[model samples]
Target: MVRLTPAQLWRFVKRFEARVLIGLVLATGALWTFLNLAEEMSEGEIDAVDRRLILMLRNPADPSDPIGSRNVEEAVRDITALGGTALVVVITVVSVLAFLFHKKRIHALVMAGAVLAAWASSDLSKMLYGRPRPDLVPHEAYVYSASFPSGHSTMSTAAFLTLAMLVASLEPRRRSKALAYVLAALVVVGVGFSRVYLGVHWPSDVLGGWCLGALWALVGWIVLRALHAPTRGS
Candidate 1:
């Protein structure tokens, strides 16, 4: 076996170091962007795009009338339930238990912690903002909380994305990993859309929730990778 020359080895080391630095910078940028969005939202600044989108979903003649048929409304309600507190709790607990059963205690614990943190963060943001639910249209679903940074939208995204990442990490095939990510994304998007369609959350609320949820999921993924790395000098 031939060993590399000193120059070649030095170049390789520099490339590896560069990659790590780039990754750190990207993560920092993402965190900064999320914080900026939250700050703007907390200051009661509603973007025009958000208002237009919400209005489009409502009947132009009557804001009280949502623009969907009865069956469609029923389907949307069912989809939204997937992101409700009851279902989110059940899914998280079951997923954690399943991870433990597979002897992945670290993964189980990480998931549990990530979900709890996400939930607490959502609740705290809601209280801090105290933004009320949308009244432009009659709500199709029952709601009883401050609405900015929707809890269902945030929790569903965080929980489902974490689960998807965990599943993808275990899969050896590229196709399997792609499928897992796509499915997770569809679930998150559908849940967020359902909230707006049901007239309970403003478009901006869902947008903020999505941003925060994605950030929390990214943090979970990073933590998992760091934990799985071999200790230095090992």
Candidate 2:
């Protein structure tokens, strides 16, 4: 290894510290957005607009129907299934087990913990807000829970994004890392949009879920990165 002067080492540490702080900055921004959305929703300031946006995705002639061919609608349902609770849970379990089997116990724990925390937070938010599902249109999917923030959107974004980042960190190539992130993002977007398209959630509900879920994933990723960082004076 090339030994560096103390000054050079200090500069490199400073840069690394700055990069670490970027994660915190992203988490803070997402938190602020979620809080603002929650406040506006609680004040009844955005629901009307949210409903209007959701309605825009429906057939004008028949509000109960989605604006797409039958096959396209089926395709969307399949896409939405990627965010369903059963699938997300299965994915998380597989990932956690993979880590454990590889003797990466810390990674296993972190993965499981982050997904459970996301679920708990989403459930708590739903109970606290007690927001009703949209009544303006017929729901295309079965829903049995309160709908301030779509749980599927929240859970899927949190779990999938966390898993993606964890896997990306294991990849040595930058191209693979970018692809992982891109695919995760697409999944998140598709799930959030599907919630609105299915008419089970208002647009703001999906937006709120996306914000909160992204915040959790960002914070979790930061923690994971810190845990993997080289200890000082090693």
Candidate 3:
């Protein structure tokens, strides 16, 4: 094994330190966005824009009916289900098992903890915000809680993105990492859009959820990287 000189070792430590700094910046930005949205929502400043955005997806003649065909509406509902509590739980369980199978115990723990924390945080934030569901259009899907930050968007983004990072870590190729993140982004975007399309959540709600969930997932990934640092080389 080639021994790393003092200069090279210093450079390695600095690189990881820079990564940690970037992670902190990203987390701060996400939390700031969520708080700003919550404040605006509480002041009712975002309601008009939320209603207008929701209405854009509905027919002028009928706010109850989404502009898409029945098939598309059904498809949207199915897509939204992927972010529902049941589906998120199932996916998380499977992912944890897969990580364990690969002997990645730390990854599995982080994955489970990050998603559950995001899910709980989403619920708590919803209750704290107590923002009502959009009244601008009829809901195309069932909803049970307050709608400031969409639970589906939050949980799905947390779970799916964390899962993506776990899978990407197993590969040492840039293409694999890019593909994993791309797929997770697609899922997050789709679920967020579906929430708005169904009129169960305001656009701002989805935005807040995405921000919060991404924050938690990024944190988990950063922690994993730090824990695995000893095994890393320049």
Candidate 4:
């Protein structure tokens, strides 16, 4: 019989609990504060920043105008248009299709569940706060939604990040895995920034979206891991 060294045995044992414990502790604490911090200083600061960000994110009326806002507006327009949505939709469809065809029902279920959950959370927050989008800038687009927290930002982050996590787990090589994570991060960040650049979302709205999205994604990951862990062992 082959013998296992103490160090190797210890490493395997440590993997069983250490990472999970650390991830849970940190994620729980951060999400708790993100959800709870309602003190005057924090809320006031968030409000102020949100207002300032809206002002800063607005596009200049003239494309030729010399300003720091030109690039931002272009980026926003490019991303807020159907092109961005198309890209995201394609990615989501592809992922779901792949999972379904491959018979990975669990993956498909989690992806769908996470997206819906994130959107629901975002809509609930909007209704609860009933905050309107900034009116300082001339409305570039037809605006009808409650805009305390950006739903696009939140949902996009949740979906792309979750996809990234799943891809990272499935990929075989370190380089490929890292690339997947980076691309996922870029998608989430790009979507959030696109909302701000469109003048549809206050900076605070995007911030809250990221916080909520990340927290939701983390919770989903934990649940998915728990569900899969036993299957892997079996």
The candidate that achieves the highest TM-score relative to the unseen native structure: 3
Worst 10 residues of 2 by lDDT: 225-234
List, residue by residue over 33-148, the lDDT tens digit for candidate 2: 98899889989999789878988998888899899899989999998998898999999999999988877776677678878877888899999999999999999999999997
- For candidate 2, the C-alpha RMSD (Å) to the true structure equals 5.3
Q: Which residue ranges in model 1 land beyond 4 Å of their true spot?
A: 1-30, 229-234
lDDT digits (tens) for residues 1-234 of candidate 1: 989999978775664354345545655765576567667766756656666788899889988777889898899999999888899899899999998898888778768877888799899989988888876778899998898888888899889988887887777787888898999899899999999998899887887778777767777776666555221111
Clashing pairs in 1: none
Candidates in order, TM-scores: namely 0.85, 0.89, 0.91, 0.76
Residue 215 lDDT (model 3): 88
lDDT of each: 0.80, 0.84, 0.88, 0.66
- Between candidates 1 and 4, the one scoring higher on lDDT is 1
Cα TM-score of candidate 2: 0.89
TM-score quality measure for candidate 4: 0.76
Better of 2 and 4 by lDDT: 2
Tens digits of per-residue lDDT for model 3, 50-135: 98999999999989999879999999999999899999999999988987887789988989999989988998998898988988
Which has the greatest lDDT? 3
User: Comparing candidate 1 with candidate 4, which one achieves the higher TM-score?
Assistant: 1
List runs of model 2 lying over 4 Å from the truth.
1-16, 229-234
Order candidates by lDDT, high to low.
Answer: 3, 2, 1, 4
